[model samples]
Structure formats: C-alpha cells, structure tokens
Target: MKNIPFISALFTPALIIIILSGCSRIYYAPTTQNVPLLTEQNELRIAAGISGGEEYEAVNIEVAYSPVKYVGIMLNSFHAAENSDSLFTNPVRYKGNLTEAGIGFYYPLATYYTAEVYAGYGKGTAQYPWSFDTIAPLKFDRFFVQFSAGMKRKYFEIALSDRFSYVHYTNIEEMYKIEAFSNYKYVPKNNQLYIFQEPALTMRAGLEAIKFQMQYQICIPFSGPTLGYSSYNFNLGIMLTPSVFFK
Candidate 1:
C-alpha cells in the first residue's frame, strides 16, 4: 500500500470534480491490468473487479489459464458507464466496453517468483455526450503488449506490470465539439492512432484458494496530445484459483 497515497494524491482533485460535476468529453478510459503470477502448468486464475476513476466506472473480468508447460492464455473484458443525473444541471452520460485475448509464455524465475509476456488486440466504443440531448459515439481498436513479473506465496502476492498499447479511433462523429467542453482544442480524427504506456501495481492477500486483490494503474500518452483520457485507475475485487481446491 506504499503507492496508494501517492496515486491518490495524483488524481484525487480531478476525481472529485468528475464525480461531482460530471464530464461530457472523455476520450479514453483505462481497464484493470491482469497479472496472474502463474508458476506451474495447469494453473487457472479468474478475477472479477470493479474499477473507478476519472469519468467512468468499470467492471472487469479476467481469466488466465496455463494449458501447457511454459505457455499460457488470457481473456479480459471490461464495461464502463457513468452519468450526471446527480448533478441536475448538466445531464450527461458515457458508456464503453472492451474485450481482448492473448497467448504468451510464462516461466518461474525461482521457487517463489514468476514472469510472463502477452500481446493482444481489442475493440470497443465510447459514447460521450456533447449536450443534454446530443451524444457522440466513437469506436476504436487496440493492440497491446504487456509484461509482468511477481512473487507468489501461500498467503500474499505482489506484482508489477507494464502494458504498451496502440489505439486507433474510428467512426468519429461530431467529435470536434469536444473542445468546447474539455480543455483540449484538437480532436482525434477517424483512424488516428495514439500510443500509450500503462503501468500498474497489483497485490493480493488471503488464502491460497481465494484472495482479495487491489490494483492501481496509470496511463501515460506517448505519441499524441493529451486528449481527455483517464489519467489513473483503481480496482478492488477477488481472485480465485480453483486448482488449489483440487490439490
């Protein structure tokens, strides 16, 4: 929990504003990074979590399975939505979803340490309100490569992961008007590509079969001007390893 305070400080004010005032010009929202510290074959990990920050709140589902020796696969899905009904003055809403899958290699570094790398593709849509009645729907495709390493024990685990992504926005309709609501003046055009670097810290504690999990992640734009993207994300939930029960 050493990074919790620093992460909270980075986005607390902005989070408060988004929660209280609501936003109508958000461009990108981050999902939880899945880091399963698999140390052996035939291991299965499933996690369900809720993530919130910036302009959207999301539900994240992740599955990781090691079907063979030194090989693993992962699937992830996310759905996010938010509205401004509480504000009463600015009635806006945002919605988005994404799904991705990847296959990679994993290996044990020592008796208690493991590492993995994965590359995947995903697609989703984000709807941002331009006015009380007008909504702009944008679609995007994503390609990403991620690396993770961590230590695993019977009661607790900690991991660090970094994901590099290329996002291309498509089907942009009436996106230019976002400048009127948000700080940026330039809007992303159709098929415009943006690169991002996302780093996350993940922790799990409890029993070996099931554990409480929490993660904090930050997104950094690498190639494009800062559009209205969620700067950070926080997730909390539970993780299950059914194989532990069989053993």
Candidate 2:
C-alpha cells in the first residue's frame, strides 16, 4: 500500500502543471485567516503566525487600526515555500515561492461580531523538478469578504470567521512559454479564475494586551475547483492588542 506521503506528493506534479499553466490562481492565493475585532477608536492590533500543510509552509503577518468605532483598516502579507520533504521522487526537488499583500476594511457588527472585505494581489515562481534550474512565474489577484463573531473577556477570547475568496490569474501563456516547464504534461488552458470559501475558529487566552492564539481553518469545497490547495489547515500563534490612544 502507498503511504500518505506518496499520495500527497502525487499532487505536486499536478500543482506544478497548474502553476506553470498560469490559468489557475490557486497557487498564489493567500491561505491565511484574519479575524479583526476593534472595539474603540485608535486601538491597534498586530498578529503573526506560521501555518503548514502537506505541500507548503507559510508565514503570515498583519496590522490593524480602528481610527473610529465604526471603521477600521488593516494590512496583511503572506509568504510561502514548497516543502521538499513532501516530494515523492528522488533527485526531483520541487522549489517554489509565493508572496501576497492585502488591504482590508472592517466594520463592527453589533457588539460581538465584525465584518471585513479585503483585496489582495500576489506573485509566485516555481522550478519544476524536471526543469533543472529554470524557473517560471505565476501572477494572480484576489479579493474576499469575511465575517467574525467573538467574545472578548478579561482573560480570554474566542472568535470564528468565514471568508470567501475570488481569484484571477494573468499571463498564463507566457509562463508556459518559459523554457523550464515547456515539456510538462497536461498543459493547462490560460486565463482562468477560481473561488474559495474558508472558515476558521480561534481561541485566544492571555492578559489585557497580549494573548496566545490557536486557529483551525477549513477550505469549503463548494466554491470552485482547487488544484493546489488542501482541504484543511491549522495555525498557532499570538496577538497583541495594546490600546494606543484615548478617544
């Protein structure tokens, strides 16, 4: 029987094919989960975390500010690299890097809920195992709407967020024309779009300004076809929400 590593590793080729094709935007889309809750004007919060999956490892960081009670702004970034240990074949090392940046708007929903909408763009590069040293580019844009409900207490807080994403790719044909991945199988059609929906639940426990956090995210299967992403992932990290100024 094949081990789980072999099964999971098989997807790499397909992912490599899709990434080089440039039609699917799934490869460069950020997989981080953001839950923003701003209760007062001039409040500032920063979060950082690392997440891992079968094929990739990612680092995420974000900063948010609530200038007024009813409005907030946030910026976030992500960087991911392929995991060489997950590869199935020897001497076939899959190498890739992806980076993303996003800006978002947040609105308070009642007393315990917050809603956010964000737009993001990213770029990626991959070197296929068969391609030796040549690298190919992948470019994409994305946007999402998210909602969160949480309870904030003196000692701890619990939050849950649902995020929906739409991803679009550009210059797919140009990527395929690159010399490195020119001979790969199942070449993809260019200029494609995809959608994804993810929901995450989080728990944070700590003092008034600093907290330890753990979160679980599931990529719902209904939105669109996912060629390069996993169905579920988890993140563990910390958040700092120190009050900046008095209103």
Candidate 3:
C-alpha cells in the first residue's frame, strides 16, 4: 500500500530492461492462455522459470523451480493504491508487485501433478478498506506470515508449470499495533498481527513458461478480489534469475 508509488517508479526501469532483453509486448489487451503449466520429468537437474503481466499499470514477477526436486521456492510482490514512494504527492501512484523469495517442499503428484506446502510473505493490497492502516500507528510497524496450499501441472518435462494459491494474506492493518512506523526512540512491548482476517479471499493463479535451458521465465499474473478499492489487479512481465546463487 505505502509502496505503490515506489513500485510505479519501476516502470521506467522495467521498460529499459524489456528493451534490453529484446522482449516487448504492446499489451493492447490480455493474451495469457489458460494453459497447463506442468512439464514432464526427465532428468536429475535444476530448472527455473518466470512470467509477468500488466495490471494497474504495473508489472509483476513470478518465479518457480526444480532446483533439486524436493526443494523449491516461489515468490510474489505487488502494491496497492497506497504510495510506494515517500515523495509521491498523489500517495496513490500505482500498484506494485514483486516476489522476492520463498522456500517450500514440492511433492511430485501423478507424474503430472505437484503439490506444495507453501508459506510465504509478499506485499499485496486490500480487496476492501479495513481502515486498519487508518486505525492508528501500528499499521507499518508489524509484519506477518501467510500459508497456502497449491497445485501445479508439469510442462513438457521441462521447467514450465502452473499453480494457484487459494489462501491469501489477511489481517491487513493491525493499526492499533503500529507504534513503530513513527520515529520513536523507544519501542512498545505489545505486538499483535494476523496474516489474514477474512473480508475477501485473495486468490491468485499463474502460468510459467521456461525457456533457454531454464535461464529465464515468462510469467503472467492475474488476480481479481471481489472486495475493495482495487477490486482486481492484472499485470504481466518477465523474471530473470541471476547466475549467482546463494546457499
């Protein structure tokens, strides 16, 4: 929410990268095929893929993998109408989404299906205003953890796949608990926050296409929550994996 303005600032940067990557889309409408995402298994190697689409005039990044089979990760990040930048006069620049990193266990199902015990924390928006952010000083002072159960289909025995998170983030604004976003030298002792409080469910589905020996992923992001100021968000873009690996 507070990051919307900052996220919008990335458009210029993303545009430059898109131009440099030689992958550009006019985006007149939407072109995401409701396609199957799983690839057949064939090797004892690692694979990675990414995808993104455009919504709220912002781009999203999706990442997935088979780094070893038993170990994998998925990530997502976005913003609300709230300002992503501190200097934005509008305070509602644009929606921003970015999935930094997530680690989970991937279970291969039916040689075509995969299940995940996925728990992740990514920034997102409210389907409806809970007035939590406006409630008090506790809004920005706390963080949360969320969990999801998902299914994915293998893609042509490669790094491509599709998955959905039926469960979404909740308990958006523990504003009464937000005593830190302020510049106080001393911190409070009471802290209460929930990953979700349930006004509307934030369901998300994604399709991933891995190409170039799993060097990059093309992902399309779509979400339409039936509650709030930003009822639904649709965005698309690509995610690139740095050659360097940590851990």
Stretches of candidate 2 exceeding 4 Å from the true structure: 1-30, 86-132, 174-189, 221-226, 244-247
Highest lDDT: give the candidate number. 1
**How many pairs in model 1 have backbone atoms within 3 A of each other, for residues 3 or more apart or on separate chains, i.e. clashes?**
0
Per-prediction TM-score, please?
0.84, 0.71, 0.35
Error of 2 at 126 (Å): 6.0
Q: Which candidate is the best by TM-score?
A: 1
- Ranking of models by TM-score: 1, 2, 3
1-247 per-residue lDDT for model 2 (tens digits) = 6588898798978886665444212353236676756666687888888876655567777777776665666776666666544333224444445455555566666765555565555555544333555445555666666677777676687887887777665555654565234332323235556777788898888987788878888876444443455566677788888673343
What is the Å distance of residue 125 in model 2 from its true position? 6.1
Indicate the TM-score of model 1: 0.84
Measured by C-alpha RMSD in angstroms, how accurate is candidate 2? Answer: 8.0
lDDT (Cα, tens digit) per residue for candidate 1, span 1-247: 9999999998997775555334344577778988988877899999999999775789999999998988989999999887345553246667889999988999899988999999899988877774578777788888999999999999999999999988888876566654344443445656568888999999999999999999999999989765667888899999999988765
In candidate 1, residue 78 scores what lDDT? 91
Clash count, one per candidate:
0, 0, 51
Residue pairs with backbone overlap in model 1: none
Kindly report the root-mean-square deviation of model 1 from the true structure over all alpha carbons: 10.7
Q: Evaluate all candidate structures by whole-model CA lDDT and list the values in order.
A: 0.83, 0.62, 0.31
